[model samples]
Target: MSSNVAGRVVCYSVLSPPRRSRREQIISQLLTSVGSLREHNRTVRVVVFWLGSRHQETEDRLRSLEAQVVHLGSYEDLLHPFPGGDVLVRYPVLHKYFVLDAVLEDLGTSQLLLIDCDTVFLDDVDKLFERHADVDLAACAEVGTVRRERGYDPAYLDEEHLARLAQSLGGRFVEPINSGILLLSRKGIEELAKLRPALLEITLRLMVGLAKSAEESDFAPLVQLRERLASGAPEVKGVAPLGFPSSNHWIVEEVALWLALGLTESLTMRDLPPSDAALGGEVYRRPRSASSWIIGHYFSVDTAPAMSWCRTGQPPHASPKGRSRAADELPIDPALAASPLLVEHEGFALYEDLFGLDVLSEMTREAREAYWGGQEQSLTARFGGVGRDSHPPRRLVSAGGGDVQDAAYCSPSLKAFLESLCGLEVEPTGRRGSVNYYTRSGDFMGLHLDVVQCELVVLTVLQDLSPADDPSGSWELFPGQVGRPLPSVSTGRRDRRSIKAMPGQSLVMFGGLVPHRVRPVAAGQRRIVSALCFRAGQTALEPPTVPQD
Candidate 1:
């Protein structure tokens, strides 16, 4: 069957019925998730369903993006006082349970990528199918330690009850998992329709039980309760809290899925990597480190300034980097504007058009032609050559032949430009430059600093075209982490930036001082990069000194 016959879908819910405020706020978030769709090879239909009266602007925006808007009546008409309906209106998060079954029915045999509204996708959502097609249920496991003692955790899921529910269903125990980002096949979804009555009962009972046992507190039902549970820390001490997993019931729908799974004899499940579908505070706090994460469940986060590309029938612009910003133009310094377009900061500047498109296009063509496709370099943990302090294997095919370097690396004008950026004269180091190929699927580079010889690191993504559905091989730069441990780059690196440099762009970083690595290359992706190193001295005459790695 052709893709035109039927396509897959990604689903999200937003600002519930009668709440017409925060229009642009939701639009930005919608763009964040919608913008991420460009990374996917197969076109995914965006379906926004809600128990609501539609906001005209949001509908118009969705129409402009060619998204299909599915409005399932109003809260007063569809789900008045039905079982679990009380919590559904009170907690907007639980609304998915009401809409997903219908979505699955329409999808028939195809699957659905059910995600939160505030999520930002990093790679393709189709990866869930590639990795977890065999499983009936797959979800991103809650990051960090699982506080079993708390019984009900961050997702407001009653893990203890869920464990017993799973045990009662099929003697299989499920951990505390976030259902905000979930994958569902029609096979399992079919069972959900048949079990809808029982599922609602289970949801009602769970909500009542958690609420009865919940401690007394004063948090405005939706906003205050959700914000605090998501960002704040209060004591649970084993007993249930007031709003968490109880009255608010953000995770009740996830719990309903667990209940429904028990009735089905063909239940199978897997946990997706947190690096791929991160949730909560991690989405906004450390986007650079979590940049490779394709889907971010940004529940209540509004400070996601570094918005990804939002290409829905429109050009990839919208952020400072992505085509459009607030005014569509940044405050340009007259002198800086006259030079090459760049996003400059203290020690970092992302040159949007370092080498003009035509020149770099030719350079990229030359580098690809010059590649000898040498032996596959094993940079994996098993392919150990560097000392004990070496990074996770830099597994990939590399050709460091001088021809390839000379073909693209040694540009006289480029070096002169670099001299200005570095504030000193520069010369190619012994490792002048090398073409690294992320040949096979799953190939990656662990976090590590460049060798001592690398003083000025210049890297350009010659060709990042990948046939893989989940192609997320981007350059993650850790400018803020110089002296820190190699693996420490993923967490809390304030200045870390995950960059997927286009063919025309180039980056100049003090590689020896900044720790960095490449995210794993997905299947059908051939990631080729041209990395060149240079040396700089205190004065133009003295031998250049290397920064300690």
Candidate 2:
């Protein structure tokens, strides 16, 4: 099928039945995303599925952008109680059903793109359709436990109870999926009809019975509690039979539902067009083409700012010229610094051999199957790299009241590394919550100084370092400038001194002074570990140096 068959893409966010401020912010972000689409002369319909009385000004704003604005009124009149009108109204599940109903009834087009308003589209996403064939739904992988991780044992679920629940709901176990970015084709809409009533019932049980709060866990029930509530309904029980493969562990159960329902077999990115051709922009084509894309997810209110890139050299050490060291060794001890406490260094040159000379010139390719491997139960033991900042400031803490730096479902090695870097001595300011990990073809973070309050910037590159002639997986940093605009130098002109960080090695840079970014890894191999550490202080503290070059 031609790429244009992707049809006019419409992105929307269903705002709360309450909270005008949140609704406004969501509308603003939607508008901003639509504005980018407008600039490209694309027919991108933007809508806000709101609750309260519609505002003309808001509608006017969307109209000015030449995008559609929709406000889905409360359905209380259609059904007596409006099922979950109060507690579960803000959840996206019902809104999804409402939209699905419209689409199936031919009120809308063949393809629909639903996005969480919290996300900002750095570029056009129209290409998602071209690659989608045979798949009813297209979505990013939900990071979750594999069968191996789950230990193939039926005991994981109380079999008797699970059987009873499965019989009632018509499924066995529940898998997870991130509903943030959902791509539904016409086939998906039809399939959704088969599962709609059961799914709605499950969603309501989750919202009212299990989750109760706006924030919910995967296991929440939906059926209303009478004199005493029952354990679960048949639809909830049926989810287990799906047996979906868990890719992104963040929303494993949701993905499980998709797979259990036999929807997983219908999707693929193989046929999707390149983002550039679909979005129709210069910036989308070049991975490092834009500063905003380089600083992925910056200014997001959810998590602390992290320098999420890699380098190809060794850890920072005291230079013999600066202090009094040998010809070959880099300093790891923090006490050796002569300037105040934390000394700043910029560019990749200062970080020589960080990856080890031998490791820097090699390829360590893991099996592709193994590379994509993940687990759940064993997650707590393996990749935990370090402990996080103790005495975490209120802003950076999770709703769980734990440190925000903790990537909840990560391996133990990651946790250990986090613990080592984000000790009680160093606490990150503006630490909001755990960060979502993301990557793509030739994907990487570009050079920029971090605005967050952290002492050391640590990255563990996921891929092995290739030869100098093939530096596909090395780290690069821009020198002299801290959070400065892209220099007016000619295209392809780059500063020579920045270091290349290799896999397994870590670089602890004075984040404030060192303006740095990662070079995109086109193909070959590359991996990275990022941890932002801050200096200890009684109150919010700033680095003594200004961010200007």
Candidate 3:
């Protein structure tokens, strides 16, 4: 039953050594599912990559069902020299990534459909192939409902994980891609093959770093064993920086695939519609529609019983355990808890006390001295304007001291914390030169949205006088239109919300989205604030501004 024929869709499934009984049961169901594809008029072939010692009975069973089975030699060769070999060995599910490229090479098929063993076909997969014919890859997007049901939370990822994602995906994260069902064209397969070596090295380094950090755990012995095996291997180098382990080992494949696709030029990715019926482990029935459900994924809560029924030819038993609550109960790291609290509202988020009081106090003193020493300059003429008419002058002084920059923009913790809150990785715009604003009595900034240079603006209040001293000088936020000129500060618009930032408080706002201004200061008051700018992801440059009406 060699199905290595070209111009046909080869459906590939990898089965590593599982319990003998369970493996047989899954293969039986998988063969039946593959057989059903023929009735749907699909020109398809089924091939199973078995990673274990050759079992004649298993090979005979698959052949009887008209499916080809190839026994992959000792899996140890795939794991030996990699830096994170131990971790991979511990979690064998990750083996898919190491062997998938080789499987594709062996099959030599221009079109490949990779599915989990538990998945069943309810409809013709011909449409799926046609839909992705012009694209490099097509995969289902892991929806929020499915992720929550599966107990996966993106927020649980820490700074190092976020950094890896940023380096790999050009963003903090892309919509999670399910690895259970992947449709790859020849280009996509070749791309993965080309990037496999570098990707494996990086993945191993990250895993080794994580293992080294957990030296006292029960897992430490496994790492040591792997280290001994890798001692003579040239690929075994010093540990890389540590990052958090993914919720499941299979996530390694998803990450590697994403990175490979991202780095591969001339290849595009498209989302397979949820309606295409890629059901999860929830045991959802085939949807009643004009077309049948395309694929059913049995990797979730109900997989074992479904497999048991196929094995003994008996009704499936109720799942012994329901969905896992571990993900919900997972502890929030102390570092995350200690990060600044972001209170969100329409159009903005207010981060209370982002900087310590002592730091702000010292910075305030420096800014006041700069103003008094005549180092301040007028910023109104350059940045604040409504077409040709510039607003009244406001005093602007540099952060001047490196300490302020370190506290505000250069702190890794601060950057990570902000990224967590925003759910987007941000970087300094490199347009550094932050400034401290000093507004004396009678000074007021006009109502205008900030320029589109930065994705977000961080404002630290160094000194805010008491309401009694300066009730009129609070930052007045206008909610209605963006980019359009609003009525003057004295217009007393009922929609405006006045925000008073006390000393040490920080305000983080989507600069290009919210239009705001400074209220006129009272005679005895002086308002001082430090402002910094950041751009989200690498592509967020100076966006087009809203049209001025």
Candidate 4:
């Protein structure tokens, strides 16, 4: 299939069985993004690659859309068959490879642009073709999603794995780009295919044994890098990855606009208008444009350990509404502020004046209850409620756990809060950050600070009104000069701090020098607050107060 029209290019990708609610949201985003192309009549073709026994409902929906739909038969025919889980993890990479192979070989189209399903096309991306034709491949430069020791540490992977990734990337980290979005020329797609065999070998090997999470996909680029290193090639000599100077780093769609800003990094608040009403608080009409609003790390939040690869917090839907503190009512006594304010090591300043304090309070209260309430006492009982030694309540906290930990998962309020803070509704990095819970008896998490990978934490305490013994329940740190606990919060402890967080009161700790521990609960009944930790840089703004007439 040859492109008779000069402007024709294939735009393709895939989506498999997703949670019902998520499926709707992603579908809406996909249609919204692609709808932009319709104005140009640019003949945009979308290919959705799905695996497993086909779901006619899903296929029908895709077919209903004007775009093309390709069901790649069974997952087995696609590659060394991995479980549905493994398949889902590598689905994007595989889908791109399949689409490029099909589009180029079957349609004979050389030019292609691959956009992830989640993207929303605010403007014509056709310019991507115009700009990138000069380079063999063009992609948004690698935004450091997860912090890596302030420099190119590259410590996550060993030599063998790194070498494999560099090799698979075809001695070029340029093409196959972010896979979230990219523009690939015919040669680029062909080169991607050429590297498929080695890439698949590594993918299968990792999926079966080595890979722990989606990080396996990095192997493609690592293999390519290894090849270059083995040949003693200079880093700059290989294919180049395009850098968009003006862009905010996180996963959200705003990165596209940042790239649109181009050369001018120094953006005043006024330069970049609020992306939406939700962002108005954190961003404003600055007189000048500095480099502030553009960069990946600035907007990142902590998530699960495996997700440490990117800073975006857990998937947008997973975050809970963490507590909010009002700047007007200083948590620390202003009289005590004779010198620079002292907070925990990771602590950072939070403003409640610009963003409203009430909205956050209401939302946090509701979220605290909804999350904990949704889980059956039976389930909480499964972990041993207060002091049942028979079950021996494990301190296990994970994405699936529904305690305050659910805050790691964003709720609508949480998303609005973050959008206000970051000035955009950034995408959530698919990482699950840590959440800690302490129960009576066998249910205690010993004193500990989060790992480097853990960015920020919001601690919210929810306990029964009735209390007993140990007078424990207070957040503790190494005893100060008086040998009593001192609690100044920071990241991993950010958010407002509140003692006696009975039914509604909660605390949030941002970055700082604070180390904290929960006091023990009485034997009769135990108290618990769902403690949630997020990837760093992914912070939120309180909602503005609505003035009454």
Maximum-TM-score candidate: 3
| RMSD of candidate 2 to true structure, Å | 17.2
**Cα misplacement distance, residue 525 of candidate 2 (Å):** 44
Task: Name the best candidate (by lDDT).
Answer: 1
Clashes of each: 13, 98, 0, 82
Better of 3 and 4 by TM-score: 3
lDDT of 3 by residue, 458-519 (tens): 88777656563445767777544433433333335686767777677778775544567777
Residue 21 error, candidate 4, Å: 4.3
Ranking by lDDT: 1, 3, 2, 4
Off by over 4 Å in 2: 1-7, 39-41, 53-57, 75-93, 105-108, 145-168, 171-176, 205-451, 454-549
Q: In model 1, what lDDT does residue 122 have?
A: 58
Best-to-worst ranking by TM-score? 3, 1, 2, 4
- TM-scores for the candidates: 0.46, 0.44, 0.47, 0.42
lDDT of 4 by residue, 381-416 (tens): 121111101122123222122323333445556545
- lDDT winner between 3 and 4, please give it: 3
Between candidates 2 and 3, name the one with more favorable TM-score. 3
For candidate 1, which ten residues in a row score worst on lDDT?
309-318
